[model samples]
Target chain A: MYKLELKRLIKSRSTLFLAAAMLGMSVFFACVTVAGAGSMESRGYITLRGMEAIEYQRGLFAEVEGYVTTERLEEMSDYSVWARDTYGRADNMPRDVYERWISYEPILSGSCGRMSCEADEYYAERRAALARLAPSEAAIASALALNWRVDEPFYWEYGFGGSEAGVNWTLCLFALCLFCTVIAVPAFSQGYSCGADGILRCARLGRGKLARAKILAVYSVCGALYLLSAALFCAVILLTFGPDGSSAQLKLGAFVLLDMSMTGVLALCVLSGLITMLASVSFTLWLSSLLPNGVHVLALSAVMLALPSFVNAYMSYPACDWLRLLLPTGSTGLQIGMYNELAAYRFLTLGPAAIWTPFAALAVPALEAPAFALLARRAYVRHEGA
Target chain B: MNIEIQNLTKKFGKKTAVDSVSLTLTPGVWGLIGANGAGKTTLMRMLVGILTPTSGRVLCDGADTREMGEAWRDMLGYLPQSFGYYPEFSVADYLDYMAALKGLEKKAARRKIAELCEILSLTRVYKNKIKKLSGGTQRRVGIAQAMLNDPRVLILDEPTSGLDPGERVRFRNLLSEFARGRIVLISTHIVSDVEYIAAENAVMKAGRIIDAGTTAELLRAVEGRVFTARIPERELERAESAVRVVSLKNEGGGETLVRYVAEGPLLPGSDFAEPRLEDLYLWLFRDERRQDDV
Candidate 1:
């Protein structure tokens, strides 16, 4: 029975069309990420984009790729000050001097501009910021304790600017969620619309066994779609950027809270996106069981998928933020999703504990998927047709 | 197998669809005759356990069918008045799918599908999509799916609406042979479909079983009242407005032959005629037809 149900789902024209669209979007977004990449020569002349920019930057930063030690930080600071004093700006220096000296300035300056500070000052400031942001003393201690896992010297390497690919992947995940909605919204409601339920509900196994088969098939198809598209996107980006920066710390500056490597961050983002897809599909199936028309389910599912992004964009209240994080497709948004939350200091305070937003985002949907799936089964089994 | 419908009633809001109906069904072919909206479909849906009744219960061998659950459904086959199939499935695929839902093993399903396809003349279109088939052929496929499990209690609603005369004859023959020891309940307004094969018949009107008995017994209600008369062609319209005309035939030479049902001889030269189930149907639903015409 399960095999037959799976065959029925796979043979549908709409399912096939949406699956093809997902695969096509994966390649298209990967290409967009690569095409938008840009880099400049050490002399600040002869800028390049696309693969040329990637290849040039890879060689320019190769020698300085190990770790950012205190001595290296002081040497970068001394060169930056000398270049500014001699030529008024680092970009105006001679090409050889800028290539060997000023090329590492972006990594040193980062976003906070405090990357070149003394080791003691940097650690003290990070601790103070964490203490101010943490909900309680225990939370502050936990936040500071998390810093011990950071690589001691902080590895530095040319990442081919992989963050561009990461941003595009977030948008790709949003599109995949919509495509999954289209595929799953009709799993049970089509039977009501087309009059198939009249005969189906009379079959010996139609009540429970058939509902289980349909739910399993829908999950299998959606999961496979997410895995395949994600792999394609990752392959295209990794092939173009190479794996040179897999161990580079994501926390490029003192303010960024996460201490994982770039590769680990990417893996977490992909896992969260997959969970968000499953949760959205499960909710859509439950709606399908309750509603009698597929179009209505599709409309409702699409609205729910977009609601989190809209709330995150136009609302600033703390409750609104919690609402955004708790929605089924919460972590697939481009503006305030799992990928961005990992780099920020956002946390959810519960009594005397502070839970990070990234963990809450992943945990909520993991529980929702099974809960909605059970609701869907119950609705289908108890359904009475006209 | 025995199915006793005890005081079955179903209501939608304030309007009652099946009102306090009761019947006991045993092993034989039974016919449920009614006009449109006489609660035949509602009664059949309740019997299948898809629609819950308002104030009654269905018993299978003295056990409540609701408690029986899947066990009750296991011995049943049903074809609704109108049904649809998944657009992607071919005829063979649909039958195979239904067989699996009916809990037939793979080899047994394949064998039964082949046998039913031959019996229903669907071999040539086995691989064709159901939506592409003719209406009559689609109805035949519906019948095939209902019989795949060889159910002990088979219920079919309006099973012969789209069938031509030849196909109807074949269907009647099929049911006659399949109804030897099983309970086959067929609900239809076309009385001839069950006139010859039914061992017992029930007549419904306005959501109630007004009459029920053997065909010979049901026909007795309109036996002496049915008559045939010869009248002038010009008077045919006036005669139709005065009495219930079951049929009319022009004999040429300005004379027409009319077969009608009435209390007594209301024409110049009227003769008694042998009665069939159709005469009783028209006689019983005369007021309904009047309301429909108005």
Candidate 2:
């Protein structure tokens, strides 16, 4: 049955198309990650603007300039003369004197070391100094940088950069499984919705064997998708960023990405995929059983995913939280969070309606889910033969 | 072990597709003949437990199919109209997969797949993708999958629809070969497909079984009403208005041969003839136009 399911899945156009599309996307994402291009990272594009600021800072001595002092001139506190000497390579200068005058503050504090630095370094030091004066602005800027994971591109680019392909892979599998469930509606639902396959199933061994086969086939498709997606995500992440990136690593993007392990991120991705895919498949199966049309399942899933966010946004407080919780999309947040190794610490509290609910409401005769059982039963009953 | 339906009724909203239809049968080829909206398909689906009938019982080998669980399905085979497939899978792969779904053990499934492939003439295209197969071959694939478990009961709705003459003959022969110890319930618009294999036939209309007997018995019921006549195209409408015209053939030179059903007294120019299942079927279903069913 397993082998047969594999072959059958390979035969289906939608599944095949899904796999192909995933492969193509993985390859593209892998190549992009390999290129080490930062444009794809996130909300910010650092370019010629920083260079303009660098050029302007050259005119300042104590122009209250932003440039960090790379070096200083002793006799003349004029950085213009020092800049000329340094261009000739701040060569063999007196380290103590150079350091003292550059950090010196003419109005308030005594100067410290360091006169000139490169554009990035200059900005870094300037922020540090300004932080001493006004902590709010400096703190906000730093927080923003940390949020975007931009501090270290080596970690972000290498670690999470390559992870895009894998994420896409996992996402595609969820999509494929969702697709199989919905598609089965048209093929399997009629067995009962139209009652076409009943005669054959009843007269022969089809009552059990045929049903088992359909289930086996469905899961086989799901398993294949899951395995493939996992492999793709892992492979892309490894090749681009190196396998070690799955652990804690620095990253650079809009802001600076600080401490995070690669393992935690992968765990999150897998958990998200699992929750979404399972929910999708189950919903599809259930819908196929009841509805003659399969589109209803897809639509239901879409609404499930979208409604909670919409309601949470408009209602201010949770309006249909229970109803939303009934949906896979709503339930997935807890599922994903709990499954993730890093984020597993998140605690959950079930509200009033949830507390008194009977476990039987969640229990189904087979697979314990309406979608899975409905589809399987429908497919079995609707078997067409002769 | 056989199939038995007791007081089985299925409804959709206010309309009934099958109303308290019941029957008991052992293994053999049984032909279900019906008008377009007869409850044949509906009754078949209910028996298989796919569609839960509003009220009644469907039993297979004393095991009520509704609660038969998964075991009963293992021995059943089905082929619906317009079946679909992955298209990417090779013929062999598709068959093998279906064989597994039928619950065949690996070793047995493999052997069964080979046997069915050869039986269905699918061996040559075993490596070919289903999408690449011709319509006839696709239908053949459908038949083979139904036979994977050597099901005790088989239901085929319009199985020979797209076959060429040669393929149809072969398919009919194949069906006859497998009829032993198995109940083959077939419903088709084409009478000829079941003519050679069916031991008994049924005529259905308006969710009811109006006739059930041997083919000869059914044809005998309508014999006195049949006649063949050649008339000018201009008289076609007049002749049609007089009785139920079952078939019309162009005889060239603007002349036509019209075969029709009438209760008594063939017109002087027309000739009396034996009835056919096709003619009987048309007469039964065309009752709406006939305005009276006795």
Q: Best by TM-score, which number?
A: 1
i-RMS for every candidate (Å) is 0.9, 6.1
lDDT of 2 by residue, B65-134 (tens): 7676666676678776665554455777666656655656779978888888887788898888787889
Residues A142-191 of candidate 1: C-alpha lDDT, one tens digit per residue: 67777566555566677634448777888999999899888998899998
In model 1, the clashing pairs are: none
Q: What is the C-alpha lDDT profile of model 2 across A1-386, one tens digit per residue?
A: 43454455466666677667655654555454444323211112222222232222222222432222323212224553454466443333354433333323221111222313332243354345433422244444444444354222222112342234333443344344445444444434545443334433443344545555555566556656666665675676564445434213221111112344455545545554554456555655555545554466567755654553465345433234344445554433221221221221111124322121111112211233445655556644554332
User: Which runs in model 1 stand beyond 4 Å of their true positions?
Assistant: A41-44, A111-120, A135-151, A160-162, A244-259, B289-294
TM-score of chain A of each: 0.92, 0.50
lDDT of each: 0.82, 0.56
Please tell me which predicted candidate would have the highest DockQ against the true structure: 1
lDDT of 1 at B78: 94
The TM-score between candidate 2 and the true structure equals: 0.62
DockQ for candidate 1, please give it.
Answer: 0.77
